[model samples]
Target: MDGFDRFRAPPPDMLVMRPLDSMVAIFHRPSGRTHVVASPVPEILESLGPDPTDVATLLARLSERFDLAAGDREALLARLGELEAAGLVERL
Candidate 1:
């Protein structure tokens, strides 16, 4: 994959998001599971639209709305991995 992984959220109807104080509760319809996510995780999910997006593009989109640190790239990659594992996001 050249280490430039692309990701996309499932269809809107497949997931339901609810905001809690510092976390978001996401219900994955297909799995009948709910995931509790925090911080950049929620932002990341919100940034992903219907189209698949690469890391660079996703970072750009996030930057427009949030103040990101230089080390965020590594953190983002790690979070994406977590989200993928949780079925919250799909790696395309």
Candidate 2:
């Protein structure tokens, strides 16, 4: 949780993502694994531009782009945890 501002998407060269309707199929070149992720995941990755971003900044950006509810922090954080666990994102 420390250094949250250092959170960033995985290295671009290590991922190959493709949209599949409402879902996304991400192929991790490093792990040689494929993941079928839903909304928020794809959206989150897209929102994470080319730089590291903190939760607050990311939340604000996501809110502007998506129709997020009044309180979606927990949900987004939870999804971020999952993505980190899956090695799609990292905290520096």
TM of each candidate vs. truth? 0.90, 0.83
- TM-score (C-alpha) between model 2 and the true structure: 0.83
lDDT of all predictions: 0.86, 0.80
Best by lDDT: 1
| Candidate 1 accuracy as TM-score | 0.90
Candidate 2 per-residue lDDT, tens place, 3-79, comes to 25456886677778998988889998888999998877877987875488888888889989888886687777777
Model 1 deviation from the true structure expressed as Cα RMSD, one decimal place: 1.5
| Model 2 misplaced regions, further than 4 Å | 1-5
Q: How many clashing residue pairs are found in candidate 2?
A: 0
Tens-place lDDT digits, model 1, residues 2-91: 248999988888889999988899899999999988888778888986579998999899999989999888888888888999988899
lDDT value for model 2: 0.80
